[model samples]
Target: MLFRVITLFDEKKNKIPATIVHGATIEIIWTSIPALILLIVAIPSFALLYSMDEVIDPIITLKVIGSQWYWSYEYSDNLEFSDEPLIFDSYMVQEDDLAIGQFRLLEVDNRVVVPTNSHIRVLITASDVLHSWAIPSLGIKLDACPGRLNQTSMFIKREGVFYGQCSEICGVNHGFMPIVVEAVSLEDYLTWLKNKINFDFNI
Candidate 1:
């Protein structure tokens, strides 16, 4: 447009095209395009947000707790032998102690386990400071605020390992906090639960 204007008005000093001060067509075009684009984009956004919020009668419920530099998880459903729920803490692996094929600063001593193709509920909270529980593959990035509880639901579609890290800058060692999720078949999950139950019982 600038080159065209320069070529057209090269010999004229004061000759200029009149500007469209008030064109209803231009106004409607400008207004309707973005609104139509926004309407198209919002359909999937609202669907995903509403789907994440829906609980859908989850088969398992997991409670997550965040501290200054570590993450704690609790299996809060379907335990009968013990009054307290199954709980454990996860910490990031040190560089020197990392095993072969294990990702440094991403591996943890414990991994949160769940079953594939099943609905799961996660309740998040912080014990001392603010933290965020984020898993990119699962589209989860909920805040773990102190004195308040936040909840979300997830459904693992396949059996695999997913990894994430603490996204909030709560303290100096915040980078050291990592999260790992192990998704397995339902039979394998029950076997793991049995083994875990026995181990916790023995402990």
Candidate 2:
């Protein structure tokens, strides 16, 4: 699509004769074309945003609290959850902890976990300075402003570990806070959750 647009402009520039057409026609032509293309993009984007609130079934709910240098995750509901509002602190992995295929300053000790294809809503806030929760693939990011709760809904379509980082500068360790999301199959997620609740393992 982008190549087509650029090629169209190049061809227009080459063929447009100064003696034949006025500049206003060129402006109108480009303007209308882009407007029509923009409409094509805007409709779907708006529809996706509007459909965020709609969910089939949510198996878990998590609350995230951003502090000076770390992130805390809590399981707020236990209908299909496994943990006592467990708080897991996510810290940036240091150079010593770096491994092959792991990101420098982008890997965290603990990652936020969710089930693939499950509707998950994240509740975000800050304990001190403001921060932001962002995950690109899942298309979620919101301000974790102090004293205010921000919400975002997500439905993971794939199973893998996706990473993000703190977008807001909070304190000295602001750059050290990294976000990781582990998406797994629903059965595996439920099994892990059950194990976590049974004190089988620290998930």
Candidate 3:
């Protein structure tokens, strides 16, 4: 229809018909087309927002604390740690300290461990400066502000090591602070939890 209208206009020396120029069709077309397009786009957008906000019965809850050039993780839902939670700090592996196949500035000494196919809630906060915990594959990017707690939900679909970084510029060493998430099987995660609990207990 548009092609035909353009062709007609070109053939008729840019002249428009009197009926079309004065018709209600142009007004209705302008309004209804945009409305229809918005309706088409809004459904999925609203669904994604609702999904992001919705928190299900999470099997585990992890608290992440952003510090100066490093990240700390605590497994708050682990009942084994009755008094102290299973907490550990993750530091960036320098280029000289990196092992074979390990990425420089991207690898960390410790990785955030979780089980696959489970609903996990992550609470984020900063100890000093502003930071952002983001993972591209998981589609999560949350701010870590001082004195304030932010939260997000994650459900790992598979088992792998996913890497991210402090997206917000907190300080000079912000580039060195990296985030790594290690998703394992349920049994492996339980074994890791037990080992970490024992290690913390011994300490």
TM-score to true structure, per model: 0.73, 0.68, 0.74
Q: Pick by TM-score: which candidate is best?
A: 3
**1-203: candidate 3 lDDT, tens digit per residue:** 99987776684674654554465888899999999999999999999988877678999999999999899998988765566788899999989989999998899998899999999999999999999999988999999999998989999989999999999998899899999999999888987887877744421
Over 1-203, each residue of candidate 1 has an lDDT whose tens digit, in order, gives 99998886675765675676798998999999999999999999999988768798899999999998999999978467566678988988788988899998899988899999999999999999999999999889999999999999889999999999888999999888899999999988877876776644321
TM-score of 2: 0.68
Clashing pairs in 3: none
Residue pairs of candidate 2 with colliding backbone atoms: none
Cα lDDT for residue 138, model 2? 68
How far residue 126's Cα lies from its native spot in candidate 2, in Å, is 0.6
- How many clashes would you count in candidate 1? 0
> Which regions of candidate 2 deviate over 4 angstroms?
1-57, 79-83, 200-203
What's the residue-level lDDT of 65 in candidate 2? 93
| Stronger candidate by lDDT (1 vs 3) | 3
- Model 3, which residues run further than 4 Å from truth? 1-51, 199-203
Clashing pairs in 1: none
Among all windows of ten consecutive residues in candidate 1, which has the lowest summed lDDT?
194-203
For candidate 3, report its TM-score: 0.74
Which lDDT value does model 3 have at 183? 98
